[model samples]
Target: MRKLLGACSLDVFARVDPLELIAPAPQGAALALYVNLLAESLHAAGRTARAQANGNSYGETVGELALGLAFELGARQGDWDAFCTALAAEHARAPAFWRQAGGEALLRKKVNDMFAVLRDKVDADNYQVACGRPCSPNRLYAYRMLDTAYGEIARLFAGWREHTAQVGAILGRPVDFSVPIEVRQLQSVAACRPEWIMRWSESLERFGGAPGPLHTKSKRFESLKNSPDKIADMLREIAEYEAISSNRDSGWLHDQDTAGAWIEDYWRVLDESAHGATPGPDLILEARTEELDAPMVEVAQAAPVADDDPLDAVRAQAVSLPPGFLSAARATQDPGSWAGRMLEDDSLPVRLAVYLKLLGAEDDCYPDAWRDPSTGALPNMQQLAALDAVSLPTLRKRRDAAIARLEAAPRTGG
Candidate 1:
């Protein structure tokens, strides 16, 4: 009883530390919490501007790092929807912060911070591969996981429905009931409903499904499956897919020329990684070719430059020039306005990456920067909650502004 009291006291003590609220004791989710803990590290590095000028990309890169780690971890472990919603919320915010600092500062910060998360995430991915899950562990998200779990429950219900026929046939009685409650009334099956699984997961005390151990009186639903492995696999699957769903690397980025000047080595490095294997035989190559051949829509430009198309100029600027406000501005055919030049650039992804680079990946990257002295701390959930304090939806406003500015630019501005 003395030992039990001590352990309970220890848990309570751990909870009182605000830092532990994010990380938990002994690191249940170190990589995850560290993604946030980074602000503390960067705060240690000095002011955001100073840290950014060196290309720390601390905030943006940390998001990416967390994504890769979360993807792998979620794929291996637990409930996914809550995990992914948390990530989607994180990623959607950083690029705008990076963009405002200008590209040079953004690059410096990213270069500064990527080492730790990459190592751990890659390790997680390697483990996932070795484990031989039918899909990589890092591939699912919260909603999809819930969907899968729901499907499994439905199937189990169907099987139970079928099983009743066998039971009735043996017992010389009619079998009827959706979740086997009748059996529970006469026996000890408890008639646990699968719906309860999701209900339990959504509760706040459970951390959106990161509940304590399943084999407990409060979590009596575990009896429904009878096999511990079944629940373990389902829970682990939630974690895996959540990890994968948050990764930013999907899409046609493997395509050459689709990427801006900085990525000219796409083909070369891909070949090198494959030990000089011919590119023609690659499926990735074929898919890229197909995508590139699809109709290309030309985004209108803002101003005149020596090159009729400022897209090439932007490419040159990215490859040969250092990233900064003027470098990106000079790349544009037009130098008139900030976002206008981005729309004027021919490569859409580069234009977007540049925005993401500058803005720090969130829609509200430029929100009321004037408010407060600026901690440059990545906004906590509390700070972000304050973002809704602004009357207009940020994405709607930015999109309106970008399109308005792009359309208003003179054709010759290109």
Candidate 2:
């Protein structure tokens, strides 16, 4: 069945458009395209891995590539069973054609052509997601062209002695027998200059007998010809992402080991609290206040609340706030303090909500009166939202705004 599927020409299955491939089609051509693309990509990846001398086996490389492609397709289509069913249907078509000589290589070439078109569709969608901007397959193709140009230029720079005239043209200076400093310093894509790129593009026809991407008659990169700034920005973006991806790969093992390590700490803390091994919630260290250069002001303490306040009755019946909770909590605030002054316009519940977000509900600095009696911690967002007579989203927006204000405020002493 696998041989029969491999033997079938991809053109028969490639007639379906990319947009239709994401949805169920009666012809089941999408499944054939996906399967063939996966197979070809694995083969290509395995060959590249071996050439690079990366110490990875072809089986290991293909296995990893297959898993990655499966995840990408699954995320896009949300149905693997359909692909399987379509595979079975494809195996049963054109049995005579399946036995024809040279069908496998022809099928591989056709499959590559189909994905060459479809790859832009997938990458364009991903570009929008990553950048929050619209992009076209044509633009993706342009990026590839620019990347290729960079690679070629780097190759010329590496062998500056052999390609002295071309390297000099790219550098806008004459080259000598001695090793050039630029060649030694050109370590990564980020260091490749816009002028070097432009000069290389302009000089390619003279040395290589083929016009560079920007210099070609093709209008694909026409707008980028005179715009070195745009070219520089794109080159920087490529370099930045390459560095980030390299870092992620380097840290993969450490990340995997530490991923779930936090759960153990969480359980240990809960167990200690239940066994009464932890200190009382009120036994918190003194607040650390930075001394500003300016003179401090003395703010008056809030007046005590009467025992019969309506809020006290509501709290007692509902969430169990301690007596004089509001008054006690407010008395601790210094109106002259930076955070206090910034959040002064917000209601008490909103202020508490900000603390709940920035500091967790059980921060040691929170006074006992500020905590819910049952939970021995600050009230949750929902509870605080109810106290403020607002919806949870409104409370969240206000909380975020308040935090933003605090973040933007200038700091005094360290």
Candidate 3:
């Protein structure tokens, strides 16, 4: 793991103000700095990984970091073309800065600042989406600070003999000639006591002549200053994720094959199915319909059927649907709408299913009747597939085809 700081220097702690860090950058240059810094970091990490005789841990770390930042960037909803144009503008403004001495570190810091803010924004949005709760960016920064504090404390604990006074202050005890049992027993951040964290924050002023994050006179962590329980919860969350990530990294399946091995499996399955080793190209199974209670809708076929046709009854028996599905579909239909007219040949349920796939399960435009009663959202792909009496893959193919048609369709009016 890379240390946040080279040594335990609390005084030199970087402030977590994204606005201030980005204030110096030109209006359109932030994204450019982020991209260049990421490329540079990845290149450096690659070289370091190659130079190391033991393992590629450095490269792995950098790759994971880049992946995370990329995810945040992707989650953002904006004009990407504007961002690209802004990046070009920034380069034009700083042609000399790109080749100047010490410019690399400055640019890297700017990139870090951009990501720091972006991470909090992305996480805040995710938290809202997942939990239906509000999470401020400052709160996320506090969580980061707490995690950093735990890491620093862990580092200090590992070398207690050299930093006896600091460690003793953190433990709220005097240093003696004998080794402290707390230092010996502390194996991970999970084992670190809540009281130890409070004490560490309190003791920072005595040693470093500066207040710690929690003890600082700032409103950023004000809510966390007095709540050790909250701090403990945050620390535990960090430890839990660390443990989970570490376990996943060392899993046996990771060594089974290269990342592209799944492509081979995909092709093999397709080949087998094509050769008639599997039941059908559609992979539909009648047994899967047993779980549903209502008859399925045949959306793929648009041929008109007689009201009392015997074939209709036989087709209805092939698949099942949830109770009241047909009524809900009927209630939500709008024949004059663009979607309704375009998909007029398909049943209302199938039209809703396509809309559900295109626009997510929950959308402002979706009628309450279209939502699954159990979830208060649109039915999932499996449920939609079951409604149509087709396999999941078949539903996906149909949905994608519908999307393609919509994209190709010409617009009439503004």
Candidate 4:
């Protein structure tokens, strides 16, 4: 009976635990409550032994770190108020004080300060590899939120006919319930495209007078736009995590032990040791590829550098370029003007990936002045994977596809 229960996904575990509200709240509230529920669910699944195995007394610290990161991420991305209000509306609860004017700044400061402590505690490298790359504590929080959102979407998909209005809302068009749900329409959420969420949010203005999660101003959902593949990947990762988490004998538990041992041997001695070892000639090596042997493709820039395309306006808003783009961004505060530029691109995911790369923070690369004051330069590949809520390889594929689109765009004024 216990073994049977363990097979259920975290979404299923939510049903067993009463703490999780039926309706959504702010991401922070929702995730914080869910993690507590997850900890308890671990016991029900008979895996508390592993959760409590380490005698470090860091009870639920991992869960706490995850929730903390979610709140900070919301603040950093300018998404806190919009999301909180939407959630409160969904749950029919009054918006929190923090959602009010003059409250957001206070909340932002608090969240930023909290992350200062939390980031130091988390071993980001270990967390990234284990949970999927680009894995910071904040990214982990985003993954769980997206996982939950996918589950919500899946639930709605199950009874498309019964809830035609909601289904129509999701489809971005009126639906005929008398007819069967289209194969492309009501398929599993894992198979569902991320654009559906964006459309649903866009379509909701007429129905609910509010945007859907994906359509909001938040960078939290930025990576998810038009990327069905990424959506599917995150859903699977959550499912896999739940499966391993519930089974004590699963290799994940063993990996945890291995990680803990590594910490004791290497991490602890790093500062004290005279010579700290680094990945070098012996441990790290570059791969040799046939491409290296191939002749390089040469392309000339014939377009006048002085003339900015109408599209540059959108690119300016969506990304932070090496050439100063701040002036254009500041000239227009209306995102709608530039948001449509994304539509001109073939793959929305690729466009969004490009934006993330150009706009996101960088480490040890660009001068601080060049980066976005609010969110730094683009993230590394591993971090990009986390932002997109996918594995490293998947992000690379999408990023490459986006680059191809850019390269293919015709240049004028030769």
What stretches of model 2 exceed 4 Å from their correct place? 1-110, 121-136, 249-259, 264-414
Clashing pairs in 4: 134-382, 134-383, 201-212, 360-377, 360-378, 361-376, 361-377, 361-378
lDDT of each: 0.33, 0.55, 0.51, 0.41
Q: What would you estimate as the lDDT of candidate 4?
A: 0.41
| Candidate 1: segments with Cα more than 4 A from true spot | 1-249, 252-333, 336-414
Kindly provide the TM-score of model 2 when superposed on the true structure, using C-alpha atoms: 0.46
Which numbered prediction scores highest in TM-score against the true structure? 2
Better of 2 and 3 by lDDT: 2
TM-score head-to-head 3 vs 4, winner? 3
Worst 10 residues of 2 by lDDT: 286-295
For model 4, the stretches where C-alpha displacement exceeds 4 angstroms are 1-132, 158-162, 172-174, 178-192, 248-414
Tens digits of per-residue lDDT for model 1, 1-414: 112212222233233332233233443353334322332232233332433242211233322222223223322322223333333343356533323445334333332233223333343444344344543322322223444444433444446666554444323456677455434432211222333343333332333334422324564344433443444555555445445433423335454224422222233334333454444534444444332211122234333335343322332232222113223233432333334333553332333333432333333222222112234322332122112111111222333345444434323242
> For model 2, how does the per-residue alpha-carbon lDDT over 290-331 read when each residue is reduced to its tens digit?
222111223444444544444333332232355466666656
Each prediction's TM-score versus the true structure: 0.21, 0.46, 0.44, 0.30
Ranking of models by TM-score: 2, 3, 4, 1
Predicted structure 3, TM vs. truth? 0.44
